[model samples]
Target: MASEYVLRIPLDRHVITTQRSLAAVLEDIRRVLHDSAPRSALQGHLVAAGHQVRLIIDRPEATDELVRCLPDAGAYCPATVLVQAAGDGACLAYDSVASAISPYQDEEALAVAELFDAEVLSLLRRVAEPAPGESGQ
Candidate 1:
């Protein structure tokens, strides 16, 4: 699998999350997931952000570990992230909840964020060799 994506979101006890996306692709996806999936006690808000989804955390130290992994890009793709108080968490204000998010960004961080964003994006690559009985030149 190609490795070049990360899902970094911070969590806190109280977070106000609002978001807009660089591209329009996840709005529909968030609507469907939110409308159907059963809410978990641990989950806060999994809402839509233009074409992406907003993942807001409401826990302690949730962002500490995550911030260490990601670069401080202020408001960039993957998230228009915001870190509040020291104990406060982060806001991945764009989840691309519809299209899908690339999970692997680096060797240290694997495609683990797929679990958090709850979506998967396929790596672009061509498969060598032909399938059995398939045409070959």
Candidate 2:
């Protein structure tokens, strides 16, 4: 059986409000992931709710040294990253499972979570910044 790991990163309300904004944010995220993890393959689709976007990242042949350290790392499962608009704010989530049997599964999961957290937060900062002539609210 596989155990799942999830990491949630919250975003400001103004960051994502409409379908156009969501699409822009998703594209930015895709670019960041592509640059950071070039080996990973990405696929995106809209969820049934029509308010969420899900991005699938497959790294079956992961070349990262950290992932390589885990036993049977070649069998690592794909990760699902979701962006959803909540009540007053938005949220970015990273979900993946530990499909391989290894003593370092938990550790690997944490490491992956941290990586996603950092990347998402960094992206948020860039996207949430105010324009040159506008004051941040």
Candidate 3:
């Protein structure tokens, strides 16, 4: 079954300074995924009003493996991600899930969500890192 993962990366100070814009960061992620997992169908676009980028990754194995490699790929900013699997329901922000209605089905779903969060955060940090000899301004 195909699992849909939505990555919502905000254009914060770190992102703005490193990536310059949401489009740039999204493009970087697209390139990374393309190079790392050629078979995974990756689709991404910017949500201008929110000043963030949303990346949709299809396929379960591809999503799991590709996301794991992202942290090592390059620098970027960390953001919330939503993972939705058919029949498995959806996993949202943990802190907000309590006050807001949740679709979380089980612990396994939460584990996957956490994994995505960590990997994505690492990926963003890598993306935000300064190049060669340039100072991270």
Candidate 4:
């Protein structure tokens, strides 16, 4: 009923065609990200970014796959929102519940932030959301 989360990444021009479930899509991204970097290094990147932050992703294949994964029921807040496009990158704005917590507020929170942030950054730098020149195909 309400917007939950937003995800942004580099737009790839070739894979925007078709849609898939959100979980499956994110799972792909997660796998790619983990494979691309070490946990400690990703966490350090987030720490260096100064705690809370926002980002943009431009990968379309990945985004379309994520859109396909959009669950029919039971999805975590803000993590559920599809990315919004502006210029070259797309932005994911999660619901307030997702954005309100600060990684620095507590150890557990920090851990959560580290994990997600790492995933986001890894996707941003290493993976393309779709094939080149793909836009909503």
How badly does each model clash, as a count of residue pairs? 5, 0, 9, 40
Instruction: State the lDDT of candidate 2 residue by residue for 1-137, as single tens digits.
Output: 99998534332222333222454556566665655444543223334357777655554333253455653444433445567765444456543333222345457654653454444445555544443563322
Against the true structure, whose TM-score is highest? 2
* Residue 21 displacement in candidate 3 (angstroms): 5.7
List ranges where model 3 is wrong by over 4 Å: 1-27, 36-53, 57-59, 62-105, 135-137
Better of 1 and 3 by TM-score: 3
Per-residue lDDT tens digits for candidate 3, residues 1-137, read 99988544333222213422333444455565664443333323323325233444333443454346443211221233332122222111112111111133334433544454445555555544545774422
Point out where model 2 deviates above 4 Å: 1-20, 30-37, 40-50, 58-67, 72-77, 95-117, 128-137
lDDT of 1 by residue, 1-137 (tens): 78885656543222332222212123322333343234331223444545444434321122232334543321222332222212221122233321122232442222323333333221000111223463322
After superposition, the stretches of candidate 1 with alpha carbons farther than 4 Å from their true spots are 1-41, 45-62, 73-104, 119-137
Predicted structure 2: lDDT: 0.47
Task: Provide the lDDT at 84 for model 4.
Answer: 34
Taking the tens digit of each residue's C-alpha lDDT, what string does model 4 give over 1-137? 78786544222121121232333334444565344334233311111133223322222332233234432101221232233333354333333212333322444443443345345444443333555664422
| TM-score of candidate 2 relative to the true fold | 0.41
Pick by lDDT: 1 or 2, better one: 2
Runs off by more than 4 Å, candidate 4: 1-81, 85-99, 128-137
lDDT of each: 0.29, 0.47, 0.37, 0.34
Ten contiguous residues minimizing lDDT sum, candidate 1: 120-129
Q: After TM-score superposition, what is the CA distance of residue 108 in candidate 3 from its true location, in Å?
A: 1.6
lDDT of 4 at 33: 36
